[model samples]
Every structure is written in structure tokens, then in C-alpha cells.
Target: MGFCEVVEGRHSIRAFQERDVEDASLEAILRAARRAPSAGNLQAYRVAVARASSVRRLLAQAALDQGFVAQAPVVLVFLADAAASAVKYGRRGETLYATQDATIACAYAQLAAANAGLGSCWIGAFHEDKVRAALGVEEPLRPVALLPLGYPAEVPRMTPRRSLAEMVLDIREDA
Candidate 1:
């Protein structure tokens, strides 16, 4: 699929098959995330790979009982390395750029998963402290997103989207 098709086809998969995700597929996702653009090229992000059922259970609990999270064959936790960005960009790096870097990387990973015919869901509603504790994340590294990956058991319908007229606003001074 082309980039546009990949973007359009990608959806939040909540139900996953018991089949495990291949190592190669997981590597591709991580690689794509690494290639994601970051502020100052700092790449102020890290990803924690979780494949163990015990770990996924803890993550699911941290995710507030999102059972599907635990069911996925693999979970990739995107973390913001604030200190890494701060060293180069100062306060803004710590407060914003680091988060942007993590978020962009997660987006790239999601796309990569879709391109590989794998299912994934981007989860961000978990308690921060719980996720940190569950993943054994230390200071200066903040969890930004939880991506559960596997073969999808269900294919959700296409969700509604705002039209370009409603979502876009062109700012121009000349008529």
C-alpha cells in the first residue's frame, strides 16, 4: 500500500489473535520508529519491548483494565528521554521536544505495523506512575504511548472524519 492508503487503513485494533508477532515485524516497527524525525536530531525517545505475558498483564493493569493490551503478542512502550533532548535544546527540549519526539516515533511505529499487515493499538489513557512502575522506567524517561501489536481478530469499521473544509483553514491576505 502507498503512504496514503497505509494511513487510511490503519485503525485502532482492540481485538487480537493469539498468534504471535514475528521478530522481524517487530524489528521493522522499531527501525521505522528510529527513523522518525526528531527535534535537533536528538532522537529523544526510547522504546521498551514487552512480550512476556506477565509483563503484558502488568501493563494491562496500568492501562486501566484494557484487556486487549495484555492479549497482544507484543507491546512497545514509547518513552520520552527528556534529558537527552534537554542537553541540546534547554528547557523547551525537556518540556516539549522530548514528548514530540516520542509521539512522532510512536506514529511511525504504528504505520510500520500497518504496512506489515500487523495489528496495533495506540494507548495513552494509562496512569503515568503505574506505567512507569510496571515498565521499570526510571527518572528522565516518561512513558508517552503503549502500542499493542499482533494479528487482529476484529476489523473495525472506518470511522468518520471531518471534511477538509471543516478541518482546514487557509490563512491568506490576498483575495
Candidate 2:
């Protein structure tokens, strides 16, 4: 599918099939995430792939009882490694770079999953402290998004979106 088609087809899928996602497909998705642009090339993100039942249970708990997280074949926890970036780029990294890096990477991963014929949902509602504890992240590394992936159980209809003219702003001196 073309880029526009992929974008149009993508949706926040909450229901998934029972089949497991292939490792090759997961690798491709991760590779796409790695290719995402980062601030000063300091890819300040870490993805924790949770598949084990126990881990998924903990993640579901951390995600405010979102059972779909545990039900999905793969739950990718995208984390911002502020301390890692700070170590290389100094204190400015935390405030300016790490969050953007992680968010962009997560978006790329979502697109990659769509291209691979998998379904995904970008989950941002969760307790930070609970997520940190559940994922065992060390200090200064924070969870940014939770992505649950698998074959979609139900085909999703397109959601309405604002027109380009409404969302974009053009301020030309000549105009």
C-alpha cells in the first residue's frame, strides 16, 4: 500500500486476535522505529517488548486495568531515556530531546505495524510511577507510550479528521 493508503487505513485498534505476532514482523517494526529522526541523533528511547503472561499482567495493572494490553500478543512500552541522552548531550537533553525522540519513534513503530498488516493502539493514559515500577526502568528513564499489537479482531471505520486547510497555517509576507 502507498503511504497515503497506509495512513488512511491505520486506526487505534483495541481488539485483537489470539494469534501471536511473528518475531520477524516485530523486528521490522523495531527497525522502523530505529530509523525515526532524533534530536542530535541521540536516539533517547527504549522499547520493552512484553509478551510473557506475567509481564503483561503487570503492565495491564500499571495501565489502569486496561485488559487489552495484556490480551494483545505484544505490548511495546516506549520509554524516554532522559539520563542516557543527558549523559551525552548534558542537561538540556531531558527538557528538549528525550520526549520528542521517544514519541517520534513510537509513531514510526505504529506505522510499521500498519504496513506489516498488524493492528496497534497508542496508549498514553497510564500511571507513570506504576509503569516505571512494572517495567523496572531505572532513574531518569520514563515511559511515554504503551503500544499493544496483534491481528485486529474487528475492522475499524475511519474516524473524522480536520481538513488540511483548517489544521495548517500559511503566513506568507506576499499574501
| Model 2 residue 138 CA deviation in Å | 1.9
Candidate 2 stretches with Cα past 4 Å from truth are none
> What lDDT tens digits, residue by residue, belong to model 1 across residues 1-175?
9999999999889999999898998999999999999999999999999998999999999999999999998999999999999999999999999999999999999999999999899999998888888888887899999999999999766789989999989787887
lDDT digits (tens) for residues 35-90 of candidate 2: 99998898998999988878877888888899988889999999999976787778
TM-score of each: 0.97, 0.94
- CA lDDT scores, all candidates in order: 0.94, 0.90
**Top candidate by TM-score:** 1
Model 2: residue 171 alpha-carbon error in angstroms: 1.0
- The segments of candidate 1 whose C-alpha lies over 4 angstroms from its true place after superposition are none
- Model 1 C-alpha lDDT versus the unseen true structure: 0.94
Per-candidate total of colliding backbone pairs: 0, 0
